[model samples]
Target: MTSDSVLARKPSGQSDGFEHHLSPTAAQALRSNPLSAKATSVLSASYADSDIRDALGLLDKRGIQNTAETRRQLRLAVQKEVIDSNGDIIREFGHVAEQLKRIGLTIASLSQGCEEMKKHISAAHQETAPVLQEASDLMKQKDQVEAKQQLLKAFNAHFIMSEEDIATLTSTAEPVDDTFFAVLARAKKIHNDCEILLGTENQQLGLEIMEQISKSLNRAFQKLYRWIQREFKSLNLENPQISSSIRRALRVLAERPSLFQNCLDFFAEAREHILSDAFYTALTGTSVGGEEDASVKPIELVAHDPLRYVGDMLAWIHSATVSEREALEVLFISEGDEIAKGIQAGRDSEPWNVDGGNDFDGLKALNELVDRDVTGVARVLRQRIGQVIQSHEETIMAYKIANLLNFYRITFSKLLGEDSVLLESLTTLEESALNQFTTLMRDHVAGLQGESQLAPPDLAPPDFLQEGFKQLTAIMKTYETSLTSADSREADFEPILTEAFDPFMEGCENIAKHLEAPARTIFSINCLLAAKNILAPFDFTSTRLSKIQDTVDKHTSTLVEYQYSFFRANSGLQPLLQALAPLSDTKEDLLSIRSLDAFRPEVLIQASQTLDDFLPLALMDAMENLKNLQSSKMARKITEEAADRFCGDFERVEEKLVASDDIWEQEADEETLASSQPLKSLFPRTSGEITVLLS
Candidate 1:
């Protein structure tokens, strides 16, 4: 090849290949060859100008044409330069060659096989075109015929489908969409129109048609219910489609004379399905009638049962009944009628038999299945409640008692009217609970009249009684809402308050009858007063208004007499006055004695003896009796009387001493002075024990 052609064929310097080791002769030949310069010039474009120029400068400095040894060295250098520049490209080329050898043959076979398969598939499509086209045309025609038949079925009244027939047709209908919705609507309308048209002309024919539709709807729901009972543990009754279906069925049946009976059956059956055992347990944590045992009564259980359980049950029934009632009202009954308002029960609304002239209850043999209204359910609850109260009796607590009454009250307000017997039942329950509480009060106070000693002034009945009062107070608040009479509020609380006050009165009576000694009678009366004071906040006075005044008057009189007698027995004043005889022959002068020699030693000895007899005993007795006194006023009064009497005696003795001192001073007599000193020494200071005792 020419030099330029060879350079282009192989990469610039790669035209001449390297060996494992370069021979000296080959290196000498490469150094003198003009191709090296040509190759370097060609590779100049691939490298930076500085690198190429430096390499060329080193070549020039070493001399291009040198000795054979130097030239060999130059040739070795050129060989290294060429190899380093092309090393990556050479290694990559070798790796690509190895990979191609390993997998290229298999890939070629795959590509050829794919091409062949594509050809065969195209040929198969061409072969089946006519047959597929014919099948498509046939399906289109069948669909058209089926659509026409559905349209005919939708409009034709005579084409009434049985439950089984509809089930078969629904399977063929496959996916339910707008078409099926339209079909159902049209079918519903056709049935309605036919019944109306026939009834206008031939009443018997219309009745037959109506009965047939009713049976069909009932049968359809019955089958659906059976399947659901078998298949599902729960169903979503809130689903709009399910609700719509029920309502539509109700409307169809309601237009006929048999509206009430049919709705009643449907409602009862639907409720039965919805109110499963699992559902009940999930809601109430107990079975339908609620948990009961001989030892543990349902009344207590009812108290503990969460209010939400009743509220939820009531809510579900109310919602279902209201929905069904609304649908029925759209067809048969006027909005204002008793039946529409659910005031007239379904069982009562049944028509009289033409043959017997006797009315039939709507459910016939299945009357128990039908719940007449929420009121009827509440009535059942009331019945159970009565049993509970009868069985539980005294075992029920005050809050529980109030709660039972409140449950009835709140429940009646939801579903019952003023005229409902359930409301009367509620009143009866309230009266029963109140009476029970009254009985409890009577039992609590029954022994009060037999008590030997009065209760301490601050002593109350018990915590239970207070709790009972609180519960009763709460119950009264509920009563005000339920009873709605001003007099009723008064009547209710007055009786309860009266019962509560009886205990205190009995305690008072026991005090009077049992305590006979003067001191104990005084003490007993004091205790009664303390109890009255304790209960002052409760307005017991008002409750006992007629009798309290008389009670107070009698007790007050007894109190005064006993206190006066007590003072006389304990007083030292009597003896002191007796000893200090009328010094100037007048009763008023008795207190005016002011001389040391005014009286005989017998008078002094008698006064001293009177004080010695009474003062210590009186002071010690006062100390001992301090706790028994009713009030601080009574104790202080006793102390003051003693202090006044003793101080007066001391003052008189001091006056006598001072007068004697004046006589001694005038006479300057030792005998007078000696008598005065002895007299002065004989009288004790008034400020000492008297002051301490008074204070």
Candidate 2:
């Protein structure tokens, strides 16, 4: 066969043997025959190219034939090589089979063990199911018990208080401190919370706790009350600063209204006695401790001077009142809000203690207490001042004392309320002084009225009236600087005006009654003008000034009328004016000049000569009549007005004369009229000429 056929065909049984002994990679290669065709082509190309002949020639030259036997031998050698490779592969397969058998046995043993473990696990599960269920039930019970324990702990903490807290709140051995306040607050809260419990279905526990807390709160309040009372007893109001403990105690005790008021009452009574004694010591310069400082003279030293004595006493009282109020101010104002809240809370809890819906007012309480404290001082002051007023003979001094009392009355009205006893005492004393002054003035006036000659010789203001006005001016000065409001000053000073000024004016009027009409008018004018001068500077005297002006105007009118009458009579027109008076208002011009002898032309010419003579001296003569009047300006004004009025009368007279003359002309013949002068020449002085002459 050719090398190609030999290469393409496998050795008959060798192929089966090689396939059986092949390693996996080698067996795969043989089954696929990846190089079979290439090997065949390579063999065919080698043979065609004489490569076999060349190989045989080389073999023959080596003394070897390239025959079929040699080829058979080469095939046998290849088969042997194949057999060796097969042997090695068979050994490797044997070793692999051995390893795989050992692995299979190990896997079978593992499977049997796994089956045994599965059966054991199922048996264990069946056995422990009841125990696991028991443990779960136990855990659930433990959680529930723990939750209930926590709830019980919370209940015990909230609803119950310890004995220590109670002791701190109610026991006297423990001092009032933060702990005590905290305990008291807790107790109060517990007491209030009992109302919540009472709203529940079970009311017994609520009632028990409520009663217990109520009793505890009452004891605690009583303790605070007594402590406050003790503190007040030792309080030194002379020192402006107070202790914090006392302030806190008072704030707390305000919750019990009855106790609070009682404490205040007690405090007021004690302060009243103390302040009364202190006032006496200050006045007398003799204190229980010892004599007062020599530099600070006693008020009694000035007793002879009633005004100073009263003023000093009032000053002392005022100083004491201010100090007392300042010392106690912190007690009320510092904790005002807290005290108010406490009182309102107390009002809710203890309704029976409330009084007519009147809430606690710190300022009002302070005023009432101060008023009570000054009660004794006010009484003694009133008595002493009343004595000074009664014994004093000087009317002006009495009036001054009244003014001093009035000033103090206003001062005390601001410190203590207007309705306070101290203010009322001052008011009464002021009224007493004023009454004494009024009585003295009235008596002085009555004595003046008894005088045989009341008016001055020159019709000037009398000495008594001048002296009264001097005193009144001093009083007006005092009232001007007073604390009275501007709106009320007029009203407040009215009584003083009536007392001080009116009596003197009335005395002047009464004295004027004895003089003649002219002197009487002058005297009245002098007195009214003097009073007006004194009162004009004060705003409060406007009403009185208006009245004085009216009276002066009335008297001035009288003077004008008197001057006008003088002009008429002096100018020789009185007779003619009398004649014309019956026909002055008549509209008819039928008057007969011959029937009225004064209206005759000769009579008219004679009157015109008198008028021309009087017109030159009219104002001078009128002013001479009023020379005794106090005010020259007033005299001049009256004179000028009278002269103007006389001019009007002259015009009327001139008109009447012209009319009468015309009527005569109408009745008489032309020859009879030629015998008489013209009416214009008859009345030579015209109203214009008279007006110019007067001016």
Best by TM-score: 2
Clashing pairs in 1: 594-656, 595-656, 596-656
As a whole number from 0 to 100, the lDDT of residue 491 in candidate 1 is 55
TM match of model 1 to true structure: 0.37
Reference-based TM-score, model 2? 0.77
lDDT (Cα, tens digit) per residue for candidate 1, span 549-660 = 4565465555445443443345433433444444443423432443323334455555455545655555555534444556656545654554455555555545544554
User: Scored by CA lDDT, what does every candidate get?
Assistant: 0.49, 0.81
Instruction: Kindly report which residue stretches of model 1 are placed more than 4 angstroms away from their true locations once superposed.
Output: 1-372, 393-403, 406-421, 439-494, 517-519, 522-568, 575-609, 616-619, 626-691
RMSD of each: 20.5, 13.3
In candidate 2, stretches whose alpha carbon ends up further than 4 angstroms from where it belongs are 1-149, 201-203, 206-212, 238-240, 289-296, 302-304, 354-356, 582-591, 656-670, 679-683
Q: Clashing residue pairs, candidate 2?
A: none
